[model samples]
Target chain A: MPLVDIQLIEGVFTEAQKKGMIEKVTDAMVEIEGEAMRGVTWVRVQEFRSGAWGIGGKGLTTEDVRALTS
Target chain B: MPLVDIQLIEGVFTEAQKKGMIEKVTDAMVEIEGEAMRGVTWVRVQEFRSGAWGIGGKGLTTEDVRALTS
Candidate 1:
């Protein structure tokens, strides 16, 4: 019901953590994207190494990013 | 944060439609699963034939399911 296709970058978050992340991400998208909450959905989650997908090019595993203070 | 790995099977829906699904799914997970909305997310949307996924095993494409009544 949400975007048919989507790719997400997530890290370190445990199963519970991931669940929470999805909830919030969806809420934000609905608020910001002006989409119906019922229409929201989960697509895909991609794990990345620190330097692999973010700015600053720091070497951080998905776990590292999740644990990052800032 | 939220669960990091999740596999989702979704039926027919547009980009906006998918987005809405994510938002709602996340919210539901939060309410029922007691996870944070932020942790919920879009994982993977696998297009299934009517019979490919869901009950009755009816041969329905993703669209058929999305448009399904009830």
Candidate 2:
């Protein structure tokens, strides 16, 4: 079973986007693991609260992530 | 940076339990990656909605998970 975990800042993505991410991640894993393993592939999105996810000793907020996209 | 993602069935764990899991997971990674990298270590817990998690092509519900513990 291939399990893919995607982490994002909370409020950054909508439910539909998360669903799409799960589908695409599963497909990506199946490409390597084979179609038979599709049913066992699990993709879950986990969100970190603002100021909880740290990088280089800096806590990132949702606005910080949004700024990166722009 | 070491990222540890833990997937659990929703509603099965309390907030304190999850926090403990995060701490333990981070410690486990630090043991391998060293103390200097601890700041970059990320341990996240993602929960699947009841009946959304599947194993062997069978969807698992929260009740199914609780039953396993009992």
Candidate 3:
């Protein structure tokens, strides 16, 4: 039961899509283990406006991180 | 602003507490950015039964990850 956190910029999903995404993510976790998901809580998805975020004291966008990660 | 997603076990928060936790997490993101928060979304929390989770093909707990991180 490893707590996994995923952060992303907003607007990538709709209400239903969000539900699906959450389920999918959970599914991935469950795939690794049978009953691994239990008593889990979702904090929130924070959407930062431009200039509201930075990397190493320099402004960076979620796209930037996605690019870096991808 | 990197999209950050936090997944945790349920019951650590109440409805009101969940709201606060969400806000606090958001605040942290915004602190790194002023207008960086906008258009976000929250999916859902998944709880798995025992024997449902594993690490490296063996059962593991969220506390284990927390311990590793801490």
**Which candidate do you rate higher for TM-score, 1 or 2?**
2
The estimated TM-scores of all candidates read: 0.33, 0.56, 0.35
Q: What value does the lDDT take at residue A13 in candidate 1?
A: 44
Model 3 segments beyond 4 Å from truth?
A36-44, A56-70, B1-70
Per-candidate fnat, comma-separated: 0.00, 0.12, 0.30
Tens-digit lDDT track of model 3 for A1-70: 3354655555433465445444554454443333323334233334555445665797655556444433
Could you give candidate 2's per-residue lDDT for residues A1-70 as a string of tens digits? 5778887889878899889999988888898889999998888887776645544334566888889877
| Candidate order by decreasing TM-score | 2, 3, 1
- Which candidate comes out best when scored by TM-score? 2
Docking class of 1: incorrect
User: Per-candidate DockQ versus the true complex?
Assistant: 0.07, 0.13, 0.15
lDDT: worst 10-residue window of model 2 chain A: A51-60
How well does candidate 1 score on lDDT at residue B65?
Answer: 43
lDDT of each: 0.44, 0.78, 0.44
Winner on TM-score (1 vs 3): 3
- For A1-70, candidate 1 gives per-residue lDDT tens digits of 3332323344444566545545565664455335443364444444544455544655546655444423
Residue A45, model 2: Cα distance from true site in angstroms: 9.1
* Alpha-carbon runs more than 4 Å astray in model 2: A1-7, A12-70
